[model samples]
Every structure is written in structure tokens, then in C-alpha cells.
Target: MKTLRKYLSAEGLIKSIYSKFKKIQDPKNRTGKISLTDCLMSCFAIFSLKGLLQAEE
Candidate 1:
């Protein structure tokens, strides 16, 4: 049950981060304009999800 709760939390957090990523829009911004903060956040989220998957296994 604890593992299930952790998995759900991680999933929800990842989904929220992805939603925020999708919302980023700047017509004048170039590919180089990607926010470093967002990039780091996404990396962290991916790592967290990977850890959670390993835990489940």
C-alpha cells in the first residue's frame, strides 16, 4: 500500500510538470530560449519516475 501511494504521487507530479511544459509558448523565442529551470525540473521528474519504477519492481 505504501508503494502504491508513492507511485501515485510520483505519477501525479510528473503529469503536472509535463502539463506545465506543454503550456510554455513564446512565439518570438528560439529553441535556445528553453528555460533551464524547466529543463532541470523535467530531468528530475524523469529520474524520480525511474526510481519509483525500480522500487515497484
Candidate 2:
């Protein structure tokens, strides 16, 4: 059996979570070029990777 954390951390599962997160209102004034979706994706990536995101796969 898969652990809950493993199930939740799956790539497909993360994509689904991102889709839902995209609909939420952004606090930023939508000023800079960086989009809210990009911001959220970055945050999620950093969080899911435990802040050790790297370039090489």
C-alpha cells in the first residue's frame, strides 16, 4: 500500500493540486511580469522539493 504522502506527492497529483490553486485570488497587485500561476508553481516546487531544487535532473 502507498503512504498518503507518497500519493499526494505524485507528479499527476501535484498537477491536479496546481489546477485548483490557480483559481484562487492573488494578493499581489498583478504588477510585475511574473504571473500568479508561475509564482504558485515555483512555491509548490520549492516546497515539494524541500527547498533543495536543482538544475540537473
Best-performing candidate as measured by TM-score: 2
lDDT of 2 by residue, 1-57 (tens): 654564556766887878888898887668889878888888888766753566433
Please report the candidate that would top lDDT against the real structure: 2
Candidate 2, superposed: residue stretches over 4 Å from native: 1-9, 51-57
Residue 8 lDDT in candidate 1:
55
lDDT of 1: 0.64
Give per-residue CA lDDT, model 1, range 1-57, as digits (tens).
344453357666666676676686755565686575477575665566677557656
What's the CA error at residue 10 for candidate 1, in Å? 0.2
Error of 2 at 14 (Å): 1.7
lDDT of each: 0.64, 0.74
